[model samples]
Target: MNYYDGSFGGMHLIWWILWFFFIAWIFFIPADIPYQKSKKESPLDILKKRFAQGEISKEEFNEAKTIINSAT
Candidate 1:
């Protein structure tokens, strides 16, 4: 039982490196995957998008904007 053996310390260091790599991969790499849930758009943001796309008219956008602003 030679505690001074470098192989034991080397293996322990390798295990730590492996664990750190695994956790970093799990947390930092999956955000851009297409199946991940995206943040929900705010109501005002949706309204603005619709107005820009011509799905809603200026009057409708203004009314919705007013309502959303007042509610918040």
Candidate 2:
């Protein structure tokens, strides 16, 4: 009805360390996973993407880019 063998050879301590390390990683990692929307792109970057994707005309892109640059 007991578990302690008195000779774990540090395995028990290693398990505790690994458990804490996993918890730290879960909380501290940024999770920069793609398609997860973990990162936010700046306005200019979004505008560039729009232009490249043909979602906006060249002149429109230029105007928006100018506005974003001046605002910053």
Candidate 3:
């Protein structure tokens, strides 16, 4: 109610813009961050684990490993 003075006091447009983005980040950032992360195992790494665990013989492992390497 102090319009005679140039006092928007605590409510400026820039502050509103900043608060909009800050509140948006509080709600949206964490879930979006997990999707942005590379949480997948590489083909070579998976293959090595399989070989180590005796899921595949050395010959099969080497063949699959070669194919994985060449494709990348």
Candidate 4:
């Protein structure tokens, strides 16, 4: 049976400090990081924006609308 004596107080203090840091890291760290902004956007909103910017022709927009409707 062996045990550390009180004479090594500095070593004990360092051990305590390390243990405190380890526990703090385990218990206080967040599991999921928060997003700055939402990434979710409805498909309709994207289609409307594209249509308004004249990026797609009316036929293409209707095709996209049909695809979106079918997907949902």
Candidate 5:
């Protein structure tokens, strides 16, 4: 076997395989650009929504809001 044409010091095509993954990482964007804005519901806002939906009465909503605000 010729030494110059051998499998890169007996390693079978390692450089090509490494380059393939390196180039792929540059284009992968699941955690990068075009970020998604997350909507965080505040305690008071959530209480108001529940009251509007009839999940809780006005007195209950006011009680919960006062408790939440006093705690903070």
Candidate 6:
């Protein structure tokens, strides 16, 4: 019968692999659905859209734009 030494080299490798997977899971997995912003719309673009949709008048849009510019 052969006596085995209690070396932990294999266990160390497994622990390292598990740690890597844990970190990868944290980065890649989202806890909720992700939100995406429209690529085409700036603040001005959205204001124009609201005007076009008759949600606001051109005068109101200009007034809002002035307020937004002042706030920035």
- Most TM-score-accurate candidate: 5
List, residue by residue over 1-72, the lDDT tens digit for candidate 6: 755576767878899999999999999987766685446767877887898999998889999899878887
Q: Candidate 3 at 2: error in angstroms?
A: 34
Q: Name the candidate, 3 or 4, with the larger TM-score value.
A: 3
Question: What are the clashing pairs of model 3?
Answer: none
RMSD of each: 7.2, 7.0, 5.7, 7.0, 4.6, 5.9
Q: Which of the two candidates, 1 or 6, achieves a greater lDDT against the reference?
A: 1
* Lowest lDDT block of 10, candidate 1: 1-10
**Which residue segments of model 4 deviate by more than 4 Å?**
1-39
3 or 6, greater by lDDT: 3
Better of 4 and 6 by lDDT: 4
What do the candidate models score in CA lDDT, each in turn? 0.89, 0.88, 0.86, 0.89, 0.81, 0.84
Q: How many angstroms is residue 54 displaced in model 5 relative to the true structure, after the best TM-score fit? A: 0.8
Structural similarity to truth (TM-score) of each candidate: 0.48, 0.47, 0.48, 0.47, 0.52, 0.40
Please provide, for model 4 over 1-72, each residue's C-alpha lDDT reduced to its tens digit, 9 standing for 90 to 100.
757665768878899999999999999886767565657779988998999999999999999999999999
Per-residue lDDT over 1-72 for candidate 2, one digit per residue giving the tens place of the 0 to 100 score: 877677766878899999999999899987686468656798988899999999999999989988888999
Model 6, stretches more than 4 Å misplaced? 1-40
Clashes of each: 0, 0, 0, 0, 0, 0
**Residues 2-72 of candidate 3: C-alpha lDDT, one tens digit per residue:** 56577665668689889999999888776554647767899998999999999999999999988998998
TM-score between candidate 4 and the true structure: 0.47
Lowest-sum lDDT 10-residue window in model 3: 30-39
Q: After superposition, how far is residue 58 of candidate 3 from its true place, in Å?
A: 0.3
Compose the digit string of candidate 1's lDDT tens values, residues 36-64: 78899999889999999999989999999
Error of 5 at 27 (Å): 13
